[model samples]
Target: MGRWVLVAVAPAELVLIALLAAGVEVPAGVRATLGLLMIAVLLVEAGRWSRGYRRGRRRGLGRRAAATVAAAELVPPPVTTALRWEARVWTGLVRGLGRRPDIPPGAAAFTHHRAMRAVRWTFVGVLVVEVAAVHLLVPAGALRVTLLLVGLYSLVWVVGYVLGAGPVRPHLVTADRVVLRCGLTTRIEVPLAALADARPVRRSRDRTASRQLAGRTLHLVDNGGTSLDLDLRSAVTVPLPRGRSAEVDALRVWVDDAQAMARQVRAAAGIGPGAPAELPPGR
Candidate 1:
């Protein structure tokens, strides 16, 4: 906890130092934005604390979600394991029947873990609330119809986002390439030769890379998605799981094991520590 506190404070401290050195006052807009964000967080927490939150417009959806989660917990571990087995079988059946484009079936096994479930469910939950708001708040007739249409678009967006960028879906890593399966539409791969390195990061490194890359990085820091950053051989355009393709200099992905993954990838790609680029501890 102490280390985490230091990590959290480091960035703010750096900003303050830089501003002081430069003899510049903080911008009014920046201060206002920060203040507003703090207030928003406080209000959200207050709402969460109140019993009224449970009885809000999203109450029905909340109850259903809670029930489902509770029922899952009530099942014995062995029973849950058996159910997961069934789920895998069904998943395989669906994959076979759906006839989507996929990577070659070879030495590359399905090492991809399911993306964070909490984040996915939260996205769905927010969309449900938006849909409810559209129906209740918007006046009926053309405007309501239009707003409901907007709500439908939001549904599609949430589904696509959950399927693509948000969740850590199945990924395939082999001696030849790394295949990332993003929902139904995207199957992104980088040749082994193109992968410079793979490094696992905790909060500190995650923040470091995010700061270095800025807009280039794709991750869910607060909500907790995987943050295994991969440096590519060159800048390339890759499709985002949820939206349009963007040319990125590097890629950040979630993997189950960072050390083993980095080792295998380096061995496969024939990269060595002799290279000028310094990789953090695992690399």
Candidate 2:
């Protein structure tokens, strides 16, 4: 946190110092724009943190089971185990059959690809600043390429939108025991047993019941020193899960089964849920 604070503050401080040292009057509009931009980013981040992804949240019965187990310390380990099994099976069934896009665990994995709108707006801002700045700094015809840049930027957004909804092609490769598959460059792969720890986070969003539905996230780690914090909801987006509803359910079941197996393997390997081994202790 301290490092991040310094990182953010240092750049602005240096930029301000340089401008003042050079005797260039700092423009009010630039300062205001930068301040507003930082505020907007901070607000968006706060909103996301408050409304976490929902893939990690267990289903209704699973939630009950968790509560039940948590409420009573008198409950034996065997009872707890049974509750976990039941919850896992029930949640697996629901997730498989819901036909929703499975989200990947990492925050970056989920938001980066899907945020083309934000990127588009950013490009627009850049183009506006560039054109304005160029017009002021250079004589006519020197900024002749502004129109070309505008067209190119416009084309980028159109192409991104078209591809964003279309069928995605995955490029898969193997790196040692891990398989790497890229869907918009999101990768997920690790040996079945090498997964040393797993942690699940539940999120939901509801508006009418004064509730909000959030998504789930699973943080994972492997013994081979690979780790990923993924949101399952983000990972599962696309092509409506081919075939009939049953097929979709089957896919979901398969995914849940894989999750459970990975969790079990982590437990057996003495890995806890949540933090991956490779990550630093306080993260």
Best by TM-score: 1
Poorly placed runs, candidate 2 (over 4 Å):
1-120, 128-143, 146-188, 201-283
Worst 10 residues of 1 by lDDT: 204-213
TM-score of each: 0.40, 0.22
Cα lDDT of model 2 by residue, 8-91, tens digit: 644675676566665668888876766665666556544443333222233433554544443433334455555654544444
Cα lDDT for residue 155, candidate 2: 46
Q: Cα lDDT for residue 244, model 2? A: 13
lDDT (Cα, tens digit) per residue for candidate 1, span 203-255? 33335221123365444232244556677776556765224667665676555
Model 2: per-residue Cα lDDT at residue 112: 19
lDDT of 1 at 144: 73
- Give candidate 2's TM-score: 0.22
The alpha-carbon root-mean-square deviation between model 1 and the true structure, to one decimal in Å, is 23.6
